[model samples]
Target: MAETVFARTPRLVWRAGTPDDVEALYAIVSDFDVVRQTETWPWPADLSFTRSRCIVTASDQGASGVVCQGDEVVGYLGLSPEGKIGYMFGKFYWGRGLATEIGAAAVAYAFDRFDWQCLEACVFADNPASGRVLEKLGFEEGNACQGPCRARGGVYPIRTFRRPRA
Candidate 1:
């Protein structure tokens, strides 16, 4: 296994998450707008639940990551064993290259650590910024579909994107 590099991006550190990240993970999970557009995860997220997410992210094949700098967790990302790698940046941390930075690292991890065949993303149709992020990482867009997102407040369409493992 590649000794985790304390992987550096322009601003964030992509490292394996620990139990200590529960609180930081909760901040983003509690943000309906953040988790909703991303996954429709049941909302008004409680700290306990978010804590579990942090621990589980490391174990889940997809939809898991730790976005940190030094020691502060700024954002979180994940790549499911099933080919879904999702990401969410805190509202306070948006607009920086952090998303792309950690995202590329996560993709590298998937390829290097798991011998993953391919990874994919499902973006709510309205969220072009996310699609752009995936594009920057070399993901290609594919079939689109209407989808429901209870956490996002209602149903909406989502587009799918794919990145082949290198």
Candidate 2:
């Protein structure tokens, strides 16, 4: 299947992922450091688990795409049907400001493509860097909650952030 281009930044291209791209993505996501910051991606993630994410259908309710620099998959971005957005980048990409750049693009794309009252994101309380990114994109801190982390293998405190329609 042809990968659909979702959005692009000066340094990144946001596009639909394919099964062919799974191995590279898996390498990034399976890293303990990377997955620990995410609420959904499993630690020790297998190829099958990664493949399941790459296999997107047109009927899929929300955006699930790879963040690329030229041909390299640097990260993954997901915006669920429930309006929760999340992202994770490979270790090499950390501290690069790519997350905030891609995030701003994702926020614009979400509000433009869908009629949502706001876009929300869940940041693990420990991951203040992600919380900062959400804030950079105009999300304000909301209520706290707890959720299971597939990587952490337990529930973790979460800080919710939301960017309401202007």
Candidate 3:
């Protein structure tokens, strides 16, 4: 199958992820700051795992979109079949409004493509920035719970958020 373009923002292109993105993605997830805010990306980045995740099997089509600025991979945005959305960006790209931009696109695409009534997302409680991104996308704060963080090798406090189809 051919790669599909999923979304576009002022500075990013969200497109189907491929194995070729492994290296760039690994670079982003390798940073402790980046992975600590995430749920499952392990610390000490492993190329093998990145490779496995980047593979665009028929099952993953439209699920994992590589966020790029021009030709460089800058981030990842994915929505699971169950309607859980997750995203991450390179450290170099931090302190910008990219997350909020792509988030709006993700919400639009997921709601339209999956026709789900709601989309779910969560952020480590310490990551107020990510929570703000969700809020900017109109996600409502929901629950507070403990969640496993593979990168941190332990559980962390998390805040859940949900966005209803609009």
| C-alpha RMSD for every candidate | 3.0, 1.3, 1.7
The positional error of residue 162 in candidate 3, measured at the CA in angstroms, is 0.5
Root-mean-square deviation of Cα positions for candidate 2 versus the true structure, in angstroms: 1.3
Best by TM-score: 2
lDDT value, candidate 1, whole model: 0.76
In the range 1-166, model 2's lDDT, one tens digit per residue, is: 4569888999998888987789889999878999998877787887787888866532346888788999999999988998888899999999999999999898888888888899889988999999999999999999999988998899999999989987
> TM-score for each prediction?
0.85, 0.95, 0.93
By the lDDT metric, which is better: model 2 or model 3? 2
In candidate 2, list every pair of residues with a backbone clash. none
Candidate 3 Cα errors over 4 Å, as ranges? 57-62
For model 1, residues 70-125, the per-residue Cα lDDT tens digits are 77888877777787887888878877878888888778877776767888888999
Q: Candidate 3, TM-score vs. the true structure?
A: 0.93
lDDT tens digits, residues 21-62, model 3?
Answer: 888988988898998888888888888877777764324324
